[model samples]
Target: MAISAKLVKELREKTGAGMMDCKKALEACDGDIEASFDWLREKGIAKSAKKADRIAAEGLSAFAINGNVAAMVEVNSETDFVAKNAEFVALVNTVCEAVAANNPADLEAAKAIEVDGKTLETTIAEASGKIGEKLSLRRIKTFTKDDNEVFGAYSHMGGKMVSIVKLADATEEKAKDIAMHVAAINPKYISQDEIPQAEKDREDAVQTEIMANDPKLANKPEKVLEGIKRGKLNKVFSEWCLLDQEFIKTPKETVAKYLGNSKVLEIARFQVGEGIEKKEENFAEEVAAQMKQ
Candidate 1:
């Protein structure tokens, strides 16, 4: 089938791929727009892989949860302005909702999940192609399905950082509090046990170095090391442990005390843009580029 220029333009608009690429895809798929879209996605993923090493620190973290399922998705853009674009936000919502409903097992599975009568993989390809940027999905996480569990989500400053918490016997108010706390403090884990053993060992090593250099500890025997280690562990625990951190709502109370007898099993997860190096453009550069255009 012959691909028309207008058709190619439409495809280009829909998938920010180059006109030639869109045209070739349309021709390859015999003018079936949807099939052509899948072709673009397969190609986009290939392209994205090459660019994966770049640092992506800017984008939006989106969350969606239904009665029994929940998901958080991080979709990155080149600029903060683009992150706030209504089209981009809508795309994020669509992707997150698709993840919650379908509960795809991984990023690839979620991308394969269908949305708006099209697979997410193709939809993203179409968006990246249209947006004229390296738009990509950085991470996706879905909570374990439990009918009795309640999920909470908090997004700070337009999704720069986001926190998702899964809970047991959570009241609406408690859930909201947990979400708010996670957003503000950005705890590394729900508890000490959740912190990796390697990370703990590193912290211990740093603490030992500090203790050895202390003037007051010059003649202290190894027995003093235990006390110093305990102090260091307590300090680290208060900083990264969700249960140890002061409650955002009360501050006077720990998170564990906030729940009282409520069976609150908190699982907190967060993701910042993993691998897209943000392009930094200054005012002069912006104006120069505009003037040239």
Candidate 2:
């Protein structure tokens, strides 16, 4: 029997299990919602489902390297303590290894990759059930370098943040320094050339508006005003572009000067719990509510 997406969503809402798990349960039970709900319980996935609503903003950012290929992953847990758990750390390493080995294009494809005869999604669900928290694999990315290019990886604060950089015509030490710089500076683009025309135009407009409203610039010639706008735009790009930013180790020199002839091919950085909105609870209010219950 063919299972409908509506039925799968309905079952997921009722059980709180992963979408793939819910779909499998529905298929196993001939699209019967009640039966699928029971099926998930029997499989012990519903145990983790109970924690699905909890915020999982704390976890580790880790990476794995295999020869010329490397992968990075961020996995979230409900608390920092759980994020440091041996089992949780192992799971993150496993995820990173799987990503590097399979080189999946996206999160969905990465989840479908098999490990120990089980889908990555099922493995995560089982781990979540055992870990007693809402565990989620937030994102994964893979990078590859040519023989002449070198890859550098750095983990800051025991995986609270991680960065990887690929550099062409560079030594491993230089690459590692670049990666560390990337982890600290968090540049948006490798160079000014990578900035989109639209973004440059937007910044140009902003600078023009600021100068137009300035009394000091009102008497300035149009050509001078244009030069000022261009200079302002370049200053903004220098802050956002990696090569223009001052090097962390040597503030006297920009990253571009530090690199000399080497070129940064790619860079990736991940910080745990960067964008997730964490839950804040009032202890007294919670206690009162529990007492009322």
Candidate 3:
């Protein structure tokens, strides 16, 4: 059977494969469009797997919210340049939408959810081949709140920084401020109570050692040493706990004091390539050297 141009175009649109590849796939599948899709996917998966070992340390971190629910996603690619691609951004957005809409518990469950007849697992693998990079869905987080609660979302530097703040008895305006604060502050805990007891004990031991090392402070009364250690620990809280830090917009008041009667329910943040070891390459320098040649 002859594969028509329409079949090739349809296959190309569905798979984002090359025109020639689509035509060949269609021919190989005996003009069966569905079979051609599977054929192309099978081939793409093999090619994509070859690139899988490459490090994808850079990409976008983004979120999509629908009413009382919001979903944030981190998708990684091999290069910052690819991370900035319009198509890559769209892919991340689509992944976030799926997550928000379905509320998948994990990446495996997320991949089982279909988009336009293609499973997310297949879509990602296909995208890896399409973009010529090792792409990964690092994590997805879902935020759910009551109707009485409001949500605020902020993303900085495209998608290098993202945050979602949930507030109770607070207006949307207040949530936005808190969301921006979370991005800037990068709080480890919303309040001191949330800090683990083990972590506090660890800090206490470290602080005690510091005091012992000081000649003047070491000889001080135990009560005085305890007071100094408590003060130092409070400083840690001021630095790391969001509620204890002075609000960025209003330096005079801490974040908790600025909230007045309102309460912050939850906060979540994502930073793209936060801990990933990025390849050290100066693309500009390379380009200049090439031009000189």
Error of 2 at 147 (Å): 1.8
Each candidate structure's TM-score, on Cα atoms with residue i matched to residue i, is 0.76, 0.88, 0.82
Candidate 2 per-residue lDDT, tens place, 183-244, comes to 99999999989999999888888888899899999899889988888888889999999999
- Candidate ranking (lDDT, best to worst): 2, 3, 1
For residue 148, model 3's alpha carbon misses the true position, in angstroms, by: 0.5
Q: List the residue pairs that clash in candidate 2.
A: none
What are the clashing pairs of model 3? none
Better model by TM-score: candidate 1 vs candidate 2: 2
**Candidate 3 residue-wise lDDT, 1-22, digit = tens:** 8888998888776766656667
Q: Give model 3's TM-score versus the native structure.
A: 0.82
Tens digits of per-residue lDDT, candidate 1, 153-241, equal 78777777777777787776677688888888878788887788898888888888888888898888788778878898889877998
Task: Please identify which of the two predictions, 1 or 2, would achieve the higher lDDT against the true structure.
Answer: 2
TM-score ranking from best candidate downward: 2, 3, 1
